[model samples]
Target: MWSALDLLSDPELCAGMSIVDISGDGLETLGSKRHHVVSLYYARKRAEQMGVTVNALVISDDGGDLARYYSKKVTIGSNSFVMNIKK
Candidate 1:
């Protein structure tokens, strides 16, 4: 998550950016879910703090518990979107 913030710190890197890429993984464990939620929370917060308007490109296993949790918790903004892949 800090890596994402670091990228945003560079003007050239974040120029004209309108979206942030994130992953929701390994939701089978409590620890993973906590990490996912924390990362998403900070990512969203940092983007807002940077005065950037962005939607999340969330990738996860198709029909996965993590995907569902992410959609419910992170992608709450109307502009956000999600993708679920087979692998």
Candidate 2:
């Protein structure tokens, strides 16, 4: 998925000693923000090479509804590009 991919592509995320990726199925319920999601399928490979744990979780917005956007986050912190995949 692009979201995961974008997050991983971040230099800060790569700089992290560990990386976690989470994704969720499209909102099954209505009245939710429509989000086009992207993720990296090769996270396992990257983890193996980077010697980091490739953690993946199913994510949802508040109320467990559809999400609006896949965050493209990159910051100056040691670990970056972490999306809040919880309520």
Candidate 3:
């Protein structure tokens, strides 16, 4: 996310708006869930500070909980939203 943002931050780009679209299964299977959540929180903060919108497309299998989690912790900025694809 940071790398994408950094690339978009180039002065020559002159981007009027910056948005990050994230698509995932809404599962944190790598490391600590707590750490992942914290990292996402800070990433969202940074995106907000840069006036960037973060949106999510959540592929879920556990009812609507995954979408809710993403809406609460992942998506940020103006008109940001999460779209859930239930399995």
Candidate topping lDDT? 3
Predicted structure 1: clash tally: 0
- CA lDDT, every prediction? 0.57, 0.41, 0.80
Per-residue alpha-carbon lDDT of candidate 3 for residues 1-87, written as tens digits (9 for 90 to 100) = 666677678887877669999888955444754453445657778888998999999998887998998898888987999999987
On lDDT, who's better, 2 or 3? Answer: 3
**Residue pairs with backbone atoms closer than 3 Å in model 3 (clashes):** none
Judged by whole-model lDDT over C-alpha atoms, candidate 3 comes out at 0.80
* Model 2, span 1-87: residue lDDT tens: 334444666776545444555455442333336454222434344544544443333365464323333232111123434344564
User: Using TM-score as the measure, which candidate wins?
Assistant: 3
Decreasing TM-score order of the candidates:
3, 1, 2
**Candidate 3, superposed: residue stretches over 4 Å from native:** 28-38
Q: Tell me the alpha-carbon RMSD of every candidate.
A: 4.8, 10.2, 3.5
lDDT of 1 by residue, 1-87 (tens): 546556768777735654566665544234544653445567667766765444334455455666666666555344666666556
Every model's TM-score: 0.53, 0.29, 0.79
